[model samples]
Target: MSDITNAYIPPAALTGSMRDFRVPGGIDLLGRTEGFFKWQNLRRQNGLWPFSRATEDGPSTVCSAQDDSGNKMRGVNFASQDYLSLSAHSGIKATAKEVIERCGVHSAGSPALVGNTSYSVKLERKIAEFLRMEEVVLYPTGWAAGFGVIKGLVRSADHVVMDMLSHSCLQEGASAATNNIYQFRHLDNDYCRNILTKIRAKDKENGILVVTEGLFSMDSDTPDLVGLQQLCHEFNATLVVDVAHDLGCLGEDGRGHIGMQNMLGKIDIVMGSFSKTFASNGGFVACKSRAVKEYLRFYSAPATFSNALSPVQAATVLKAFEIVESYEGRAQRDALMANIVSLRHHLRGAGLDYYGDPSAIVCVKMGSEGLARLVSRRLPELGLVANLVEFPAVPKGAARIRMQVMANHSEQNIVKAVEILKTARQQAEVEFEDHKRPAQFEARAVA
Candidate 1:
């Protein structure tokens, strides 16, 4: 999190706030406004801004919004992480149907109590194999995996050194452990190395876990896995990577970024989500060591207290994995990347501001929170939908429209979506001109 005091703002020569606007709230409102203005300016500086609206509702198509008249909108979803188009896959549906027929719905109790079944074991084994781990533990959600893994692994006396921009789960996990925490600058290898050096000298005997994400969620940037892995090895620190955004899309055979970066054996714990790429709900943590797996099963709260995934969800994800492991998987992965490249080219050609290496996810920073939300609301008017990130999720003023590409989005659909964005940009510019004050005031002549 950026310090409120040190937050970046745009040059006053750029966008200026209306001094006469009557704000309903007091200092809180003013502070919020200042933060928003700052965020907008900073995003503009980085050339990252956009909004999301609704589009279609099918596999390989984007869904941006749903209008009040039961209509869809114009925005192409650049905000979804549904990489494999599994949400609408027939195979997934059929497998889920089979599970429903065989086991009915909902686990009757938590897994540690009574919800355990052969299905659970089967799913766990499949997940472990898919990620090249010896064992895997399931969680109710991706956040749960992060939280539980941290709490389960780190003791009160231990320290956790993490990336500054790590997800909430990583932060919460560290908090759950102890106050002995060190956060390195985002994606800065030198900063990470310095932290490791400091930790080695200051807390030599203390247990340490170095955590980072495989692909950063907001910016779609990948960490230097080779450097990080080497640093972890040199410092004798356990390395954990959350591949929530990179699984099923980046790795060879969709194993994940760890494998993609060839950091497989070097990484100690691998965490990821099924909700995004797998088109299912749940989270997982995989490790090569059986002892770590056993420890997590007993010590992890989400694993012990929470119910296992329903038979249908388990079946659905299991089938999705099968597709991911097959020749069809290669086809889908290529299609997904192709779409990603096409959309990226469109955005870049249009001179739209965006961030990170173009892959599955891209975030467009829309100058200000107001503009970001306005674009979001307007995209649906054009028949599209996307996610608007602001405040706590991102920075206070660093709002953006985050977009995700899927294997299903067709070339025609991509063209249509880009055309809509171009049109919307023109309209937005016209409105901004109509509402904005003139650049200079003319000298009043005596009548």
Candidate 2:
């Protein structure tokens, strides 16, 4: 097993992080950003920073892209979020085109006003029915839906108990909604129970929202949903599961962990995004209460203030749901699962360590940010396209390569990806050790 706790001694220029530049010292808020820009630019120039890379084509098993430096790259893509390969499905694309011709582009207003197209309404109902819940509200993006649910339901006096590894949307929503925010260890149900007990013991009058994810993207893990939900019931709390990464791709019926764990229609709140497996740009929150749905529509700033999901997006998601509910959906899920298993098996055979259970996400542990950065720099050149997860996303030194498996990824893609990844890592490891020698020599000289 690899020690994920290993830290790195980066060069003096790359020592600090974006986190270091967050707090402003001077009165000028805009000027405070210069420090972060300086740090980020250094990373961009060296190909160490991998954010904001642009893809030349649509979603596929292979990718052609350009990094921050605008250098061309063509490789096997393992960074896309399209779990079931639904983005390019003929039905999905056709629906988008048909809706665009009929309804034009924009929704014209927030959903709070006249933005509820027939497609949006149907999408909400379909999600509610699929989840076995009573009502649902739509949001412009997955992040908005996550933030809105907590921000709309919980208030200043309420308490939010969450898993420490919950999505940033949930955490930010909790932060924005109240001051009494509490987090337990990742997937630690007993720790969650303890937090709930402590919160209830001190204050039983306020509302409590317990937040968790169906599938954590970074770690590729899920919590014990049943246990967490039972704990919520015992403590008079509401459990909101973010199914952004797993929904529409996992489980027998594609209800994600909530279904696999026999939790359908039982969760207090269900929030998810269409961007992952649904092949669209929208999100939804489903619950058993109509009142709660209405409350979120008006009170959730994202829904009330932001423009509603475009008609084309809503229609595209509707078509995706149509496919996800049919026999074809089951086949797609099976295909996706097969790819996930194959990729994981190959990764293990390559003598690489990955964290968490088998899912669409596969986080291959890299141990140190320095080695990971070098490996990332070598990947594109080695004919692979995978995202490097490092500081701010994970612990500072606990970097990893996050591979998102798609149903369309063939055996060749999986086999070749692992080969290229291993090659890149080997090349980077040699370069990294040599790069460390100078710093080590300097320290020994000082000694």
Candidate 3:
């Protein structure tokens, strides 16, 4: 069993502290926010936070980021989730510009009102057709789509069984929608089957929703979709698969893990984000029936209350969809897979341990948060911009440097990145050893 199974905390236990007014001495909302910022400030000061810094250059294979010292430094970028490098594609940018000029910038209204334009409608249709679903609904962002799907479909009496390592959006949705939520071990279909069986035995009337992701971003792994679908069928449960990281970037036709598992239309619902591979900042849910789609559209708060995808966002995604289905998309996927293979081979040859299968995302195991942070901080200086993921995202001791491969990255770029990473790792180890010696001596002196 993974550490998530032992350390995972339900979302309900962590949300809505405002209602607990009777607590004698507890952190309020503002206090909680302040605490987070304080910690973030410390991380930023140490060059460990490494988030939301301005990028002076395009989000390509190699890009420039403004450092804390206000220096623009170019590096091999493996932090972006643009698996196909479509975000910087000339055709996508041109379509976005054309659509903005034609329809203006903002929708200025919720999708349920006047925000649903022809571009969004046509994009929805295109998505449905591409994913082999009967209908589709769009959201302003991917997080909203995942959260909306559960809250729209499930009620208080319903039950939700999900993977322990599922996305925060999915967990939050389940927590908000229902109280009877159970999380199985990560990627453990047998555990999921047991949970479903127990739940079905107790409640035969209320609905049961089984949720998992097409690809777990932090761990860089996937679940057995076919097996999970079978279990859901046996228990008369609905299966919702979030393909945010894999859709339009994986499988033979870029249909994601579902296609790879030969369970595309067999699953109850398919949902994903457009930011990763579709070259826009939005999300969608594809289902087999118009009635279900309409119900979600009417009930999902993000769809009903939030402004819809702007014309440019919708058009860019539509053009990206067209490109993804063309020969160019196939070539891109080939290049992406080749890059992943090459990087993994190099890492292994250098005696480094990595997690996950042959996917665009690869995680080098760093064992501890301190080591991971040190390595990540050193990486930018070594000409690599990578992400360091630690506690609350993964298990306590399983910190790693998450690297994302792109189709635009050449062999030379990958080789250079790996070499720099090796050097960074060595430097981090030395720094950590030097930092630890003082603490060890202090403890010894105290004893």
Candidate 4:
């Protein structure tokens, strides 16, 4: 028999990331993917896989959930991205039902043809007004909007200067659009200025697009928009801000950092999604020029080839915006901020550290991936629901639990989640200390 046993998976594999499996090694196109499968299988068997989980019931502060293997769970939910808790709002539901009855469920065609519902057109106008811009183009998802905007406007010869920690959609979109891409240090305006100055000094003929986020979800922080905008203006570059995480649930009038920074209509391009705050599945790109909007509608493959937002989704988002701009919306933001404060306060009191400024996304640092995976495995069993973000999302050793707080989360939910998380981590720490690291690649079955 071979020296390698049935349980012999490489030690490198244990420490490996999805990044390693991205490029296939062999010539067989289909079979090249098997290594990743086997590695993933190992993670599953070890109870280390924590992705693709499902919810058994409708969303709320607490939830009934299921893990990747279908193990049912119920707990204090902090995994969802419903920052305003508007998904369960009565008005939103009633509006969705009414639109489904009146206009049916399908958007049927792309917006370039027969897809633009009256509701969508009005939604576009309303969003433009809300952002104090002139025109808006809608997309099926926020990701698509981010991708479409860059792909539509930028060319292969043009340049894209982006924040190092920007969302993957923005990064992928920039990659898709051009090879002349530059990355500035995260939230470092001076570094951004240096890159912009270099680009302008060398290539004054082509376009340059600067991409950033209103609020970075992973770090729960924001950029100095005014400074970046000034750099963009000085360099003759365009700026696009992705407001996916903070648009409707943050700031005084719920305009997110854009309004908070007093750059409402001054931005070159604005992109956001309804999923985070509007309680629907849609996205939009707003800008000052009718030309940019028209150009994106036709040239953007995501918008041109995909079905438009359904009338119900469009109407639901419309109603969400109405509520988002209302007095009730202010109360919701206040409540969300209150919950964020409570969670952070209690986490500190309990001797845990969290990352970033006060916003809905609270990233509690958990030092190593080994301990984090153990804690993740123990959490649902401990009656808490949260997400463990490890290597490839954040740095390899800087694992964290990304808690998505909501306006409706009760004080009890916050306290209980913190306690359960603390308990789970303590238990994992004990197990980690006792278990001594596994042999590098032992010739033994996991059983």
TM values, all candidates:
0.81, 0.95, 0.91, 0.95
Comparing candidate 2 with candidate 3, which one achieves the higher lDDT?
2
In model 2, where do residues sit more than 4 Å from their true spots? 1-10, 439-447
lDDT of 2 at 134: 99
Between candidates 1 and 3, name the one with more favorable TM-score: 3
lDDT of 4: 0.88
User: What is the C-alpha lDDT profile of model 4 across 75-145, one tens digit per residue?
Assistant: 99999988889998999999999999999999999999999999999999999999999999999999999
What's the best-to-worst order under lDDT? 4, 2, 3, 1
Q: Candidate 1, residues 164-226: lDDT per residue as tens digits?
A: 889999899999888988898888878988888887887788888989999998878888888
Model 3: CA > 4 A from native: 1-28, 67-71, 439-447
Question: What lDDT tens digits, residue by residue, belong to model 2 across residues 225-259?
Answer: 99998998899999999999989999878989999
Tens digit per residue, CA lDDT, model 3, 1-447: 222112222222222222233233455655655645555555565566666656776678889888665745679888888899999898988888888889999988888889988999999999998888899999999999999999999999999999999898899999999999999999999999888888888899999999999999887799989988888888999999999999988987998888888886788998899988988899999999989998998999999999999988889999999999999998999989999999999888777889989898899999877777777777776789888777767887788888999999899988998898898888778756655565654554455
What lDDT is reached at residue 176 by model 2? 96
The reply for model 1, stretches above 4 Å from the true place, is: 1-78, 430-447
Q: Please give the lDDT score at residue 218 for candidate 2.
A: 91
For model 1, what is the alpha-carbon lDDT of residue 229?
Answer: 80
TM-score: which is higher, 1 or 2? 2
